[model samples]
Target: MIKLPTVSLAAIGYEKFLWKNITELLKTGMLIIGIYYCRKIYKKLDDLQKKIDKGEQDKYDFQKKFEYSLDKIKATIDKGEQDKYKIKQEKDNIAQEKDNIALEKELNKEIEQLKKEIERKKAQFKSAWREIPLYADWRKEEFQTVKLTLDAATAHPALFLSEEGRIVTWQEPCQELPSSPERFVSIPCVLGQLYVSSGRYFWEVEVQDAHSWDLGVCRNNVARTGRVTMSPQNGFRVIRLYDGEYWGLTSPETSLTLKEKPCRVGVFLDYEAGDVSFYNMTDESHIYTFSKQAFYGGLRPLFRLWSSDSGPLVIVQVEENTTML
Candidate 1:
């Protein structure tokens, strides 16, 4: 047989040692690579934690700003309520002032009306006191003798005249007197015999128990044939009594309110002065006056009676005054 070379134990041990070193190097390299990978994982987890912390901080800041805005809104609402209350109070004050002004105006108007009424009453009392004494002096100066006699020729047909012609009474339709142009036709009236053209004269007439009568003077040419109104426009100036009322026979008849009715009436005439005055002889009080008239023609005393039952109107003769002006 052919024989080969033999192997040693030391070479086998060296190969074993070399293999052990190479295995140790590989375990060390694997441990280093595992440690590097663990560090990369830790870095990635730390970045994620930082992002979560930043998000929490941003949430906290947003909550703080929202709370501040809510506080501002709450403060504005409180101020608005206070301003509304103040406006309401001011409106109430203005309304009350308007009512007070209206009440003051009504009180002032009533006070003015009362002042006017007090002044009117004072004037009436002063006028009555001044008239009493002035009438007494006028009666003494005007007293005189005047003889009035009725003319039968001019008397109404219904009149009954005394023989002396001093009295006239109204009677029913009597025998017609001779129709003359100067006689009254349908009225109970008569004219005086004496005509007065000038100078002052005084006369008195008794009208006792007469229901109605007219006493005055008329123009001698006055209408004696028809019924005539006893007015100055009809040439008569007179005082009349009818239905218990006295009137001054003027163009527009004037009513007179007398304190007393006179049984006897006195008449005074100033022909040149054109004044006619009447007096109540029972009380010596002046009754009325016809002032400043124009006596154009001759005037005669006139009389009118209501009826026969009304009683006669008598022409009274006064005694002549010895003490004369």
Candidate 2:
């Protein structure tokens, strides 16, 4: 280095002092800049903390809403299941009722069929009893056989009775007979003298020669003075043969069909049983029966000749132990 001039102590001290001052100034400037930058960083951190807190609150609300939605979905599912179970239960009940109705109908049908079968069997038994052999002899032995005859006191004006009171015939001109309370006025009829109150008896009448006749049981106190309708209600349970047709003189007359024309008719009475039955002696076949009659006191055997030209009807006297066949 070139030594030009001599330096003073004061100048050196001054230069040193100046250098120290400048160094201190530079340090202070750097400290101030650091402090400013630190303040800015603190502000940014505070803003970031606020944003984090807001996001946390938002997350909490969203979680609560999601949980509530899940619970609602679960309740809806449970209700749907409950409704489905109830529907199934009702359906099962309806099906059971239908099955019960069907079973009842089947049982009712079976009961009706059984009743019809029983009735048919009863009718068959009755027919068999009539068709058996030796039945006439058995009836004569078992029951009373009466030789019934017409009462002259009960004969009509136009009817003529035999001496033994066993035959009745209608004549053209009515006789001037003495008036009696028991005599038939309008009807050409006659009755038996026996007052049958109870018990069983049978009689036979020959009807082959008679063109038209009426035969049946009647009440002992029946109408004999005036015009009368022959019916069960009118105290007459009779069968009529008019022209060529046979009919039961019921309230509504019942037409009868016969397999063979009846020559001799047998009347069987069961007083206690309220039955009056007729049979054909030729074929031994049952003709008809008047059943369940409400007889109060007594009954009588009635006979009627319809016209003057009607042939004679004879009462067959059945001896004891005699066979009708």
Candidate 3:
């Protein structure tokens, strides 16, 4: 408590006291205001920090979802491509199977055709080679060369006569032929215009094309209707090539083997000798002989075609001066 220059120490004591109290009050109020402001600012800062954290979390979630969606889309694309490849592969397999089936069917057809051809060749080889005496020209001269032609009057409905009635072909669907007693039925056949009851006659027939025919002599009074027996005992002295096999019309059909296939066949018929000899004129070789057989009535040159597949038989005419036939 020191005395001031203008006032006494005791007089200034109360003023100092008052000034000190007021100063203390201002300091306390300022400290409280500072604390309040600091607290509010800290609270606002904390709230702002929370919001930023939430936003970051949302961004992270969004990024993760985007990545997941990308991966899912990629997987879906891969699966789609795999399915497309599988479908294409299946289609290719089906096309290949169809091709295989078609190839197999074609191969089977070829195999069947080859087998048939092999069988046909085998039959030809079996009947190919035989050693026999060649007919002498003098013996051939003993027979008269008969110029014969097929008779249309005695032709079957299925037979077609052409080439000056020298060709007799087996026609399909038959022709509109007039019915007669001389016309053959149930069999495709034709008789010659001239009939021989006597004398030894020799004639050559051009039997071209596939062999399914009969050539020889038949009795004029043979059966015209129904199944006519072609045996020699049944009025038919014939030799036929049937189903690639040759047969002489005997009581029990004799099989004939030849060294060569003859396109032109020569038939020598002796009525009194009862000998009907067939010759392969193409090779000048004897085929088969119908020996020592009884003959009666007029015998005509018979041409029989077994089926529609049988080729035409052409009566050959030669200019050789032998006996008049």
Q: Write the per-residue lDDT of candidate 2 for residues 1-325, one digit (tens) a residue.
A: 4332224534556534454565686678778888888888888887888888878888888888888888888888888898888888888888888888888888888888988898889778876776664455456555578878789998999999999999999876898999999899988899987678877778888998687999988998889977799999889988888898888888799898888898988888778878887777877777788757667779999999988767888988878433332
Q: Give the top-scoring candidate (lDDT).
A: 3
Given candidate 2, what's the lDDT at residue 174? 91
Clashes of each: 0, 0, 0
TM-score, cand. 1 vs. native? 0.57
- Candidate with top TM-score is 2
lDDT of 1 by residue, 1-325 (tens): 3221123434555534454565676678778887788777787778877888888888888888888888888877777777777777777766766666676677667666666655555544433432464453365465445667999988888888999889888878775689888988867789988688877778888998887888999999888765677787788999998888998998788888777788988887777878787877777666777757789899999888876676888998767653333
- Per-candidate local distance difference test: 0.77, 0.81, 0.83
Worst 10 residues of 1 by lDDT: 1-10
The alpha-carbon lDDT assigned to residue 93 of candidate 1 equals: 68
Clashes of 3: 0
- Superior candidate under lDDT, 1 versus 2: 2
Error of 1 at 212 (Å): 0.8
TM-score of each: 0.57, 0.61, 0.57
Show model 1 residue runs off by greater than 4 Å.
1-140, 321-325
Of 2 and 3, the candidate ahead on TM-score is: 2
Instruction: Name the lDDT of candidate 2.
Output: 0.81
